[model samples]
Target: MSKKILISIPIFILAILSPVAPIFYFGLNTKKIDANIQRLLKYSWFDELYSTDKFRHLFFANKHVRKKLSSDIYVKLLSHHKKTQEKFYRFLEKENNRSN
Candidate 1:
């Protein structure tokens, strides 16, 4: 029992951390974080885990592996993504406005 508990502890920790891997991977790169997240979110598994499904039927979630996340997770992810893209998006908007 003791040995099983010890072995399972690390596995549990890894399972929790694995879903948010992209956040850790490109966190430091502000210049590319938005693009990185945009790409990662297109993957069904990753997007479901983060609960960024724009359409319910689009993301095929595996309930057996893990329950789908709540909108809170998506909200937080969107907040972070928007923060990173703010300057770039604003610049684009400004350029379009000036041209018009």
Candidate 2:
């Protein structure tokens, strides 16, 4: 009886802690994912490709497509593109005014 109680106690403790394992795993994965994303974001070619209208259309066209794009990462890329485009247009406008 004592041996059975000892085995059951460890088993019960393990069952209780099992759910926490995935949470820790995912937390570590999230950091790695974020790091990889940041590295990818630094490339100009990646920026150009992500900024295209076709990419935007495909990203928003369907659930499966959006999932493939990893919506969170794509959204952040789109936002960065938006800000960069705005800055470029502002610079162009300033240049045009100077030339006038």
Candidate 3:
């Protein structure tokens, strides 16, 4: 292969991937957090942890999660706001604790 073509191939691939990179990167991180949250939701420990103010602040800082929580049509339709808020807060704390 020519030196120029060899060099260009990787660049070309990156160029194609770059536009979608942020979405994929954020998606992966969100998935990690979501998995931890899902595990936490299965337990009762979340009930106590979510009631604190500290947890609420950090939990909402994550824009992706915030958007998901606010506009989740399924959740809105099916859940009471207070109940959903409790669940969301619990998930956030779970994900935060997992990161540490």
Best by lDDT: 3
Choose the strongest candidate by TM-score.
Answer: 3
Badly placed stretches (over 4 Å) of model 1 are 31-100
Query: What's the residue-level lDDT of 94 in candidate 1?
Result: 51
lDDT for predicted candidate 3 compared with the true structure: 0.58
Better of 2 and 3 by TM-score: 3
* Clash number for each model: 0, 0, 0
Q: Which stretches of candidate 2 lie over 4 Å from their true place?
A: 25-27, 39-100
lDDT of 3 by residue, 1-100 (tens): 9999999999999999999887777553455455555544454545355456656555446664544543446344324456766666566767677656
Q: How do the predictions measure up, each by TM-score? A: 0.28, 0.34, 0.37
Clash-forming residue pairs, model 2? none
Per-model C-alpha lDDT, please? 0.46, 0.51, 0.58
lDDT of each residue in 13-73, candidate 1, tens digit only = 9899998875577343332434544555775544653463333322233221112122335
